[model samples]
Target: MPVYHQPRKRIILLIITALALLLIARLSYLQLVEKKYSRLADANAVFKKIIYPGRGLILDRHNRSILGNDILYDLMVTPSAVRNVDTAYLCRILQIDKTEFNSRIADAVRKNGKVRPSVFAGLLPAAVHSRLQEGMYLLQPGFELVPRPVRSYPYRAAANILGYIGEISPGMLKMERYADYQSGDYIGLAGLEKTYERVLMGQRGIQYIVKDNLNRPQGSLENGAYDTAAIAGKNLQLSLDIELQVLGEQLMHNKTGSIVAIDPATGGVLAMVSGPSFDPNLLTGTERTKNISQLLADSSRPFLNRGIQATYQPGSAMKPLTALAALDEGVITPAFGYPCRGGYFSCGRRIGCLHSDAGHADNLRLAMSHSCNAYFLHLYRLMVDSDKWGGVKKGHARWREYMASFGLGHRLGVDIPGEHPGIVADTAALNREYHGAWNSCSELYVGMGQGKVAVTPMQMANAMCIIANRGYYYTPHFVDHIDHADDTLLRRFREKHVVAHVSDTAYHSVVYGMEDVVAHGTGKGARIDGIAVCGKTGTAQNRGRVNGVVTDLKDHSVFVAFAPRDNPRIAIAVIVENAGTGALFAVPIANLMMEKYLRDSIPLAKRPMVERMMK
Candidate 1:
């Protein structure tokens, strides 16, 4: 159309032609000269085998190995690659029948399609693996022997605490949290294994290996240029003394209960045992499925960590906290005493005392020594019915608040999973349960640690730590620190949590009574010869609703203690189910465990006692 337009159009065409030529040249160079790039075509030539790192170790306080890592073999199969193979010889080498072999092949095809490799058989026996490995060439591209890492328990103790690992489930594969995981990946299933999984599961690596014509792996492809190094997981150092754990397990044999010990200063758990436990190794090898099924069928519930999962009434063992609450509420003084005529009447209900002697309930310290039920019941009444709070409801609410500060009716933030927070009834809940017409006398059983209030053994041991530390405690934990890592992951446990402040005299009064209990009173069975132990014994009611009516079974024996009195090193809780009294089984076992840790040995005279308790 115009002369200026012609010039502009020519210039645009030139620029476009030059750009097209440059792109072509660049492509030619990349195809013909650039050899530095990764050879994607070589992917079929070089197999990318996954190199699994050994999981992190679980170690005791002394750095001794608690769990062992053993390498096991699995037979991986590609159903599509199994063409023209001798089925009889293959099954014979794998020590399986034709039916079982066919079943596995069909299952593999269903799970992973025909091309992808899936485990045909897992945790192979050594004899079977050796035979299959030798005859593997005849089996051709169908099968490969892959090594897998498995756990072993060296101590054969703390089965429920160490836990186990298993294959990733289909449900887990769909979750965004496990997006990186594949179907065959093994994951920690329970206990410490489950809690510290991410840290313990080391990074996976890749290796490139070239195969010969016969289909056997040769050396690394291209001198391992494309390989990545696998990193072994970081080690976790626990606060547990393995010896102490073993002893607790031994003493708890033939019984159904738990023993929990904690270092009072740091809140680190020293030992935790759930009784009737199976050997942890039973869940490790080829027998895992069968052993797990058998363990699941046991009525005693060997898998349950009773220390943190099961709740029970603290019974008379709760009197110390009751005394502290009363003193803090100004309902009772340290010097206050109660009069007892073998028992006391409240709301026309008779509450029995541990002792029926004169002067046993004359002073607060003596009341505690004798576990005088009437004295603590009187205190619970006064605190809840005080005129300062102006009503029963408000006073009880304040009391509940104090218990919360003491770490009751709540989870203590233990590193392990499935901790029970226990039941600590608030006034509103009580009001509804009682139809809004209840008084302080209606729940007096709570004063001596019964009725609706309950606690796990772990909580009871932590409570002992509060009294031992005088007012504050650290959150009880099993792993003290991760070896070679910064303390950032464990900062929360290092914090000091101070319960509501009562006067120092109040703590002193409670401690005095507990000490006297071991010195000459009801809990003399808990006394260690050279160490001064402050302890409280409990005979907790195990009740049930049978056909809508109340029924009481044999009581649970419980004992909570901290030793060496002045600077307590360890605080412990022991419970024996269906035991008659705290003095019968609970107290003696706690004392022996204390001696083992503190004194390092039972004396010649105490050896008989240790043997008797072990039985």
Candidate 2:
């Protein structure tokens, strides 16, 4: 107790002095030592403008520019700076009413603070921009005309392949991935544009500028010392052949269907055409919103990318896969034969056959050549009921595995978006549908590519690539390469995927049969001179409502083919909805595509067929 009381008073005084000194130091640093806070306080007189880099161009296989940029202008405004301006004259120049102008200004102020610039009118055409620029001086410090880049489709074909871009939405701006984007920034809306958006959208640079008291931008601060240069987006080289794509589109015009062509050696997509398609130009410029409304309201669904989005029963076009599965499982040999008697009368139901001649399907080759429904039905039954699998479920499971390996009954993992994984019923699903009462005959219609089986046109084309390659195929993709880009984006497409380790004997037998189908059977309509075309025809049965009742409608015509029989270059798949037989419409289209791609032009002899199909 000697000196404790006296030391307590000194300790309290020392603590108080330390606190006062700390507060004084902070105040001195803020008010006299630092200038950053002063600059921030005067931020209303500073402008940070964005310098948007031009988007990369899209080129075809032949180095032709399919998509390029065009010069456009955006009318940006700062609400707080808008004074002594003639609102009526500005509205007339922008072709807007006074109410709309006021609303736009209010929106701009809400998005960006009253002091910052926001887009009032965007993507204006050159003609309109020129007219606006002539009178922009009257608007002065409040408004500025800034150059913006917009996509222009020179070819006007492949609208579904080359998608459009639109301004970023409020929701998108909130997403973590799009944090770098501003409210008025453009984004890819669909097709290739959407798929390769990161590669196509260039980086934006920011430049902080000094401004006068009136909010007019002077030169950059510190001679652009803090500015970061924008990097232009990498250009993409597509595997598509614009000529072939145009031809496919022309052939499919006025029809409801799709055509997909793939390069056998590389799995590169050469052409993809979905019918009822609109010109790509329709989705560009100032008319985009109105055209989109009309497209959405149309019943034909021009927005649907049928090649990758539409799935339907593949019919006998799937016969080769069924045969390969059976042969791979050792359930059938190359000489496996099933004589047709007008129908497959096994399992109590009469599944009809395409032909009833005694020797039509006496062997696998003749069976495939004739597209004999009885033969494939028997093969499917045998594969799913074989002693090797022990039960129907096990055999069906094994068969489904084989189909999946061939990229059937699933999404082929194409580069494009909106790809649907086509349906393939598993044992569990079959159990659910038939209450565990299913058998080989319970779903025998699947043997002939019917009954719950579906495939996208892209998958159909890739399957043909598998057959053409004899063992393996790369994933079907549109972009062949990206300029000034890393290989990380293309590593997946470069990997070869094997369907199975089936023997050369099995593939040879199937290829021979496919060739015979075109040379001596139902696929004769697809035969090309000097080029051995291997093809299969299919008529997929479908149902529709008629007068408030479900009824049988015209079958969908389908065809799959590959040319040269040895060094195949092209594989094609065609589907025409509500058409007669595959040989009637689909086969001719396939033949024309193959000839055009392989021989560089359709021969004079095939011109009649082309004209007929165009009708």
Candidate 3:
């Protein structure tokens, strides 16, 4: 403050001079030493570039052909960088209305700003692109065409199994893991597509290109030295026999059930057909919306995947497991007997055997061959009635354990999704159901494979496999392996579950009883010459009563069988709903499948019992 205020003007002049000198030095450095950075910064103000990757491909197990891929394309847009564009003419050429064209232009402008560029049209067909190639000057300077890839499926029959692919929605893109994806990126939606998405979706590659002021790609920035090459997706090889699947589907045309065939030794699914299947092509592209709506509207539920999802009362097909359980538990000796006089039993009025009259007692083998309901009722009571077995078993607890051992009370853990763990009622469950009024009568129906017990056809098939394997079975699976360029990738399912908790001697006896079934009993229809076919037949009544009387509503015909009793190969279960008599309906179908597997031919006259039962 001494004379300081008067020196303010001099200080200000000194500051201006220093600033000017600093500015001159900065300009010299930018124009010389940092010229490249300055040039790039200036170039970025006028031009922009985007990188795109080619989508991966999917192939069959053999790596024969492409199942999905991308074709090169020229995507174009309109922006303020261009001087003039005939909006009306361009809209007409691009099959859009003037209003839509204007709206799109406005959106592009907002996205890229008045000085930048954006994309407006994508995936122009080669012919259309050729037409526009000669008229580039007529379009706006900011318009650009970017190459892209789309997903597709071949061999459309495996629609349900292979599933469909679709564009990712905004919500999907917002997910943290999908941050790199845009709204229109394709993703697996179902089936194997959903299952193997990670392996099938290869890493994306990119290329950086330089652009001119007009926003047209001028050339590669570094000759693509930093570019990564797109890798193709791995191929998959399924255990399914396409021919067998096709035949099964054809045979089941117009029906509403599922057919699954597995190799007993390997548990490889040979054929799986859910009736009313639709072509996979229907779910691709523009026609997808309309086709999916039609399929959904159809009452048959073509998309239900019934082969693994639907569970039904396995009916008499469950008897083999029950018999094995009884024998294994030592509750019933091979000498145990029951009589089948006519069509009723000696049990109380409320609970009578399927057969009537009280004839002489028959051995266990004879009872099984005849499917005598009374024999099983006696066995069921022996296992559950603690009073009868001298408290060796608690009420229903031991029986429940035995049944669970047979894999009846739970899911078989097959490879497919949506499998149901069928119903198996115990004392606690019965308490809730009957409110503490549960009795031996409830056990009677269960022994006969009815009332409170439900199972899936897959479970029935697995039971047959267990019996065929002499009390052990591998979990069933549909996929066998995936094929890649360098190696053959394999996925073998091999987990043996022991369903029988009995001695070897008891198991042998039970096997003998099952053999006797086809040798002389209701399952004789399943017999095949030169291939000791052994099986059991059951006809379970549906829910239809008359005046407090129970009559057959529509029988669920079921049969479980295996061939060459000494060295079993294929084991099978067949259920024909609404068909009366397992001997008439399911047995013949089982025999047909066996014949197809063994002799590779359908024996028209082999099943004489079917004809006899029909009469």
- Which regions of candidate 1 fall more than 4 Å away from where they truly are? 1-45, 211-219, 545-549
Which has the higher lDDT value, candidate number 2 or candidate number 3?
2
Clashing pairs in 3: 75-145, 82-141, 342-356, 343-355, 343-356, 344-355, 344-356
TM for candidate 1 is 0.91
Q: For residues 292-337, what per-residue lDDT tens digits would candidate 3 score against the true structure?
A: 9999999989888766676667766676667777777667777877
RMSD of each: 5.2, 4.0, 6.3
lDDT (C-alpha) at residue 422 in model 1: 94
Per-candidate Cα lDDT values, in order, are: 0.88, 0.89, 0.66
Instruction: Show the lowest summed lDDT stretch of 10 residues, model 1.
Output: 36-45
Segments in model 2 whose C-alpha atoms lie over 4 Å from true places: 1-42
Clashing pairs in 2: none
lDDT of 3: 0.66
Each model's TM-score? 0.91, 0.94, 0.77
The most accurate candidate by TM-score is 2
- Summed backbone clashes in each candidate are 0, 0, 7
Model 2 alpha-carbon miss at residue 175, Å: 0.8
Q: How do all the candidates rank in terms of TM-score, highest first?
A: 2, 1, 3
lDDT of 2 at 149: 83
